[model samples]
Target chain A: MPSIRLVDVTKRFGDITALDRVNLEIEDGEYVCVLGPTGSGKTTLLRLIAGVIKPTEGEIYIDGEPASRIPPQERNAAYLPQQYALFPHMRVIDNVAFGPMAKGLSREEAYEISKRMLEMTRLAWRMNSYPHELSGGMQQRLALARALASGAELLLLDEPLGALDARLRVELRYRLRELVKDEGLTAIHVTHDQEEAMAISDRIVVLRDGRIQQEGRPIEVYREPNSIFVANFVGGANFLEGFVHRRLNGSSIIQLRGGLRVRVLDTRFNLGERVVVAIREEATGIVPSSLKSKGGRGNLLPGRVRDISFLGSVVVYEVELVNGEVLNSKVPIQMDHGRFRVGDEVLLSLNPEHLRVYPYPPIGLYRELEAV
Target chain B: MPSVRLVNVTKRYGEITAVEGINLEVEDGEYLCIIGPSGCGKTTLIKCISGIIEPTEGEIYIDGELMNGVPIQERGVGYVFQEIALFPHMDVYDNVSYGPRVKGWDASRMRRLVDEMLNMMALRDRMHDYPMELSGGARQKAAVARALSSGSLLLLLDEPLGALDVKVRIALRRELRRMVKELGLTAIHVTHDQEEAMAISDRIAVMRAGRIVEVGTPQDLYLNPRRLFTANFVGEANFMVGEVAGSSGGEVEVRVNGEPIYSVRSSLLSSGDVLDGGRVVAAIRPEFVVMEGTDGMNSGFGGLTDGCGASWGGRVRSEAFLGSMVRYEVEADNGVLVAVKLPSLSVGSGFRVGSRVTLTFPPRHVLLYPYPPEGLERAISIE
Candidate 1:
């Protein structure tokens, strides 16, 4: 078991800063995923932790010991890149045994260790097969087996599932996480996919432009993002600007720019203070319009379904409010076919608690995607 | 107004059959998407309809007129290619008006037509921009504008939004569907992505191995797919091998590994009509399976005979929180079944990876099918 720490680590390449003063601490057996868009320095962070590259500034600590002086080999960490880099000339078993044999183990001893690792990764049958003979997912499994053959406590993977298809990726991610936990190993994975990171990580570190945007548990980060970029990146949500209009009991009632008032959890803003609301598309549901408006009791806005789309598991509807602002709602696919159509009147209902009110962002919502 | 019809269309390359006997109808003002896995003959079928490759057999009709011995130009159909094959040398305005100009239209008529098409596509401001000067999305918009500006009643689109990113593709698909309806054009789109086909089209025709396996509205195909392939293709589903033990009291009970599993009686039996001792396969979508926590779990059962629908002593295998939804795998009886739930719909904290739970779903959520002639999994396995 080993804990890892990085204190204000910075890396630079001439005029460009690769990573800007990052601080991270991983517990002994935690699975942490560093997630971000491409060019967000995810690989750079992993490389620095693996001791392949030295940080321009700050300290690297491993298990309470400063690792600035230790060589890459003695760090006892294994790194797997996007592509599985197995020995082309050797069989899968030989590749997995290579790490153990390099550490002065006899041929028989190395093979014995390789057998156990292969079985753990569900690659026992493929041990005698060459890397080229295995499917994409099988080759990835072989890579994992090789990484763990060294008996390393910390495993670092950089987009290990990037090359697989959508369905295969989903299945392999769970197996990978399960294997890592079953072996009681600490894993830090890096990927650009939001779903992959959320599905497997105990904690997520979201990065943007050489800086850490947010860090927390996957559900926490997804449900309550601290920044506009984090919210938009993790899940697509519609942003609405409004101002606090009233306060009663423990809630604050806000008036949207479209002249509709909504009640939300109390915030620090004073009366008439401008704020922004973030609503997940799935959090809203639809009811037919011409129904009585349930104002003051809860949140309900009258709108007309402008468009309808079937997205497999979910049915999406683009509805235009009476004030002419369009909002998207996603509901589960109906068994009896579509329950609504284009040009139908509907009332959008969402609990006030599901409506997130935050201080108006400096970059604003429209410019967030462009900034990425 | 044009209605496209394909009667027993089949195309062969030398000795290999690229498309086999696909019979389809695209009603006037309809949007139909042909979807399947890669190498499923989707492109080959589209090519036959586009007249790029004439069918080896069968007749093609457009607006009730036979199109035999006719070229693409005479068929009066517009093709919006996925590769955005715009002329790099010409500006958007010139490119869009090229069709009418080549067809021998006057300058004033061409200008009026191109102007209206550009305005509807929101490419008027970028009309003077060249293909290289525009972004990928902009270039795609220009190509669509050019295709529609030709005044063709029928449009054949080959994955028009396939080349873009996911978010951009979704936004553009909405706009593209709206425009197609607003301009009143009949569209037949080809795509390999099931979600894209579901989102944009009025009906979907699923293909496999040069064969059109199924065709229906998105709702009909997804909720009530008759074939095993269509059940797995349209959405996420769980397949279990079982035997039809009996039916009674508005409920059909099947035996999975010698344990009775109850599904609602409203089923179209595909495997066999005999209610007793008939081998069968049951398909259930993950979203419909309901997982109740261990405490007071049995108190919910109000109307059931012989305790058939209730499955107890199930343990959670794994859990994944996928943004909009959470998926859970549970081990019950002899197999691992999945259930998908929305956080809002669940009560309190949901089941963890190792918690005990009960699994049940009404019969309407399940679809039973007879094993195909090839094998039980042949239709489900894309590989």
Candidate 2:
């Protein structure tokens, strides 16, 4: 197993700096996902680690050895790009077996390894088929199987599962993690999907504008994002602009426009300090307006449902507060839960513990939330 | 107003059938989404509706008029594609006005129409910006405005949001649907994303193997699909092969892995043709699988426990946190891996990996279907 360490790495092209003083470390056999928006320089970081491109500044060490000048072929890192390539002349089985065979294994041993890898990828039935005969999804799976069979100590994958169907993607994520762990291989996967990154990664590195915004375990990042951009980019959250009005025991009351107020379990800000309260849609709850009379929660905002979208596992309700601020609350579907329709009066329940408080951005809320 | 009708439409390119014997009706002012895997003829069907390619057999009608020999320009239909190709040199205003200008319309009318299109697309502020300066979502909105400026009552969109970022795509799809509904235009959206189709369309049509498998409202298609292909395509379902054991009072018992599992008898199964010992399939959504922590010791299968349906013992193999929900893969005693999804708010439910648990599938939630003529693997395969 091999660990990777980058110290103050910076990559520049022409007048543009793709990476700015990036420092990161990957433990042996750990799965780390790099997630960001489109122009966030995710691909550039992957390329720098794979040795496809050299960093303009700082050093990269593989297992404590400076490897900035190492050629890609000599790095022994398997890189899988978005558009994967396969040997068109070789059958699926032969293509996968080529990796192990190149490592001096016998034909029988290589074929056995290839078969196991193909089975894990759900491509065992098509082992004898050529790459030309398979669909785009099948070909993508074949490429992934070949990558696993290569026996590389480190794997660099860029959107490896983007081409497969949603169902198959979920199934393969488990298999991919299991295979990586079983082989004790270190992997760094780059993706634009937040849910995929959250589901598969042991740790997530949130990158924005070629800079690391936050890095932590999935739950920690989701529950407590450090910045407004990280809060919005990783698992979208609803934002309410307010000012800290009063401080209590481990809590503060935030004053909003139109005389509305909400309590959050944070008192770090001074009184009258402008702040923004961010709550995940999943953290918000909804009930009938009639329930306001039998109210239980303290942070209840009465609103009218503007829209409802059924997303299979959960239904998202867009509520327009009386003050004209729209907030979304995602409720999980269950047989017992009451369903709300568009144009219905409802009460949105916000738990103080689930609300996150942040200082107002100097650049304004809209600019801070922009991915670019 | 225009409503499209296709009867036995077939398109063939020298023995390779792109679409075969398709029949569909799109009502006036209705939004219909055609969803299927790639290479499943979704694009071909949409192209036929747009009059880009003529059907080899059968008939196509628009607004009660035959359209077989009509040219695309004369069809009075708007088309938006996955790739946005606005005029590079022209600003947004000129690009949107190009449609009305080419129709020989006067300057006054063209200007008014372009303004309305720009306002509806929320692109009026950016009308002076060139294509290179606009974001991907804005550029797509401009293209849509250009398509709608021609006053076409029928809109055909093929993967219009496929090229944008995930967040932008989600936001734009809602805007597109709202605009189409606001204009009262009949729309046919073709996409490969199931959640997008479910959220934005009035109804969804599932196509496969050059043919339409099933069509229904999003709720109907998701909750109660009439075909096996529709269930597998529209959402995630856990399917188990079984043999019919008995039936009574709108319920059936199926023997799977030598265990009797109860399910609700579907109308197809209650047609009096299915008898005992017949091969069938039972499916349940992961959300319906109720799981609770067990004591790890011997536990007998029970018929009734806290209102939970048929109960079985299992050990959690893995768990994943997917934003709003938690998904667990549990390996049962009989070696069947079952997927169960629960809300993430249940943080202390204690069904961790390797924890013994009891899984219950409510009878009402279990759906019964006749086994397909092909094998189960091929039946659910996307390609």
Candidate 3:
């Protein structure tokens, strides 16, 4: 497996910058997910690494060797586009064996490899079926089998499971991870799905506006996002605008609007500095007003349940605070127990450790506030 | 406002039956969501109600008035397509005012109504910008504003928010619900997204193969789904084929591959209705299944025998980290692989692959169904 690296990479389409001074290093045999929204240059970055697009500046290296001079065919990387471009007229086995045949492998050898790959992708039974005859998931598996048959050291997957349904996506994600690990292939997957990236990636690189916003393990990125964009994009977070009141040992106490105080575990900002606290819905616990007498360790805000929504396994409660701020809390739906209904008085407590504090305001809000 | 009703609705396109004999009713001012996968007749149903397509055999009523002869323009209903279909050359203000202008409303009245809609959708600042200049979410809001400016009492939205991202979808879902309720307008939204349907709709009608599988409030549909299709499609479910063993106290005990699972009773099922030791299927949600280690000694066995839930032994196959919770795929010796989700904070990440664990699921959380339903096999085959 080859480790891929991009140093000071810059790409521009006319006057628009697609990638700006991007520096990324993917370790050998590591599953790295490049996550970004649509038109965020995620696909451009993958194409650059695959040698399909040349960077306007800087160089890309594979296994410590400069790869800019190499053509896509010689880059030893398999690129799977979003639309799983399987050969429409070819059968599943023929599509998978095309890669091996292109590399001058004997017909018998290519067929053997193709058969093994098809079996691995659970498409053995459909080997004789044409792409048009197979389901979407099966066609995608054929695409994957072809990519594997290419004998590439690094795999570039751009929204590999984007076209599948949710259940099929979940099942394919597990199977893809297993395939990558079993083959010890260095894979870089680009997608906008936070759940898919988190479920399959060993590490995630969150990109926005053609720049790296944050890069870390999925759990770490979700728990402690470095910027408001990362927090809001990765998961649903309720942003509370506040200013740091005091700095305790290894923590900061933030006083939000309406004098509601919240203790955050991070001390990245100085006292009296403006900050934003991102509290995930699942981390916020709702307690009865009568239990308000019992003090809690974390920050507590009094609010009224504005709406109660049941979403299968979880119940989401939208609480409107005294300051007119709305916060949501998600808890596992307990059918036997009585749930909190709308218009009920409730207290929402945020665990300091679960709270992630960012020094910057949200992207759009920042400009709006600055104008004021 | 009008309460819309469809009786024995059936639509056909040549040889294809687009909509089967489906009956549904939408109360006045109620937000109803028609949810299903692509080609499941959700959009066709919406078009039928919008007067775009006449049903092959059925009667549509609006406030007790038959709507078969109603033209598209005279239906007094607003329609929003999945694609914005905005007049790209027109500015935001003109786009919203087009409906009022076509109705020959005075300029002053049209301006006032359009302005109110723009403000409600939070598009006031972008009134001067063309459709292409606005973002996906902004364009969708603009389209909604235009649809509502006609003062239609009934609104039909066909995947209005399907093009936006997750964050924008959530925000717009809340906004749409608030706007619908605030205006006291009866609306039917067609979408394939379960979260969007659950988040905004007062009631959900889940469709399958052109037929209505289940219709209920989001809570009722989520909590007490009657059929296996409803249970699996509305949310995540682990289905296991088993045999009916016995019953007691509003519960039925099912035996699957020598493992007993307790399930709540359904009106379609009974103690004697299921032949003794007859084959059946049990569907359980991941949230209902709790994992306990063997070190707890009697803890695993005790929790099951206490009547709180049913317990079974399984080996952990893999764990997927999903932000707030870790989902584990466990393989039971009974030939069923079930998923269990545990809160990240409550459970330590120590379970290794192949480690045997016990899964406990409450009886109320289980949905029992007969084995091999007719249309269910077709659905699985399509998958």
Per-model fnat list: 0.48, 0.44, 0.51
- TM-scores for all candidates? 0.84, 0.95, 0.91
Sorted by lDDT, highest first, which candidate order results? 2, 3, 1
Local accuracy by lDDT, each model = 0.80, 0.86, 0.83
Best by lDDT: 2
Q: Give the per-residue lDDT of model 1 (tens digit) for A136-247.
A: 7678878978998877889999987775434446656877788788888899999878878998988999999999999998888888888767877887776677889997
Ranking of all predicted structures according to TM-score, beginning with the best and ending with the worst:
2, 3, 1
**Candidate 1 lDDT score relative to the true structure:** 0.80
Error of 1 at B9 (Å): 4.4
Quick one: ranking by DockQ, best first? Answer: 2, 3, 1
Better of 2 and 3 by TM-score: 2
Q: Candidate 3, residues A1-372: lDDT per residue as tens digits?
A: 598889999999999999999999999999999998887889999999988889999899988889966778887889998766788888888999999999999989999999998876767889999999876666777888899888888899988877654555666688788778888999999988898899999999998878887899988888778777777788767888889999999888999989999898888799898888888888888887777778767577899999877776677889999889999988755421445788999899899878888775546444522221
lDDT of 3 by residue, B28-107 (tens): 99999998765679999999999999999999998888999799898899999988888999999999999889889998
DockQ versus reference, model 1: 0.39
Q: Model 1 Cα displacement at A80 (Å)?
A: 5.2
Interface RMSD, model 1, angstroms: 3.4
Q: Look at candidate 1 and give me any clashing residue pairs.
A: B264-B363, B271-B370
The true-versus-predicted C-alpha distance at residue A79 of model 2, in Å, is 0.9
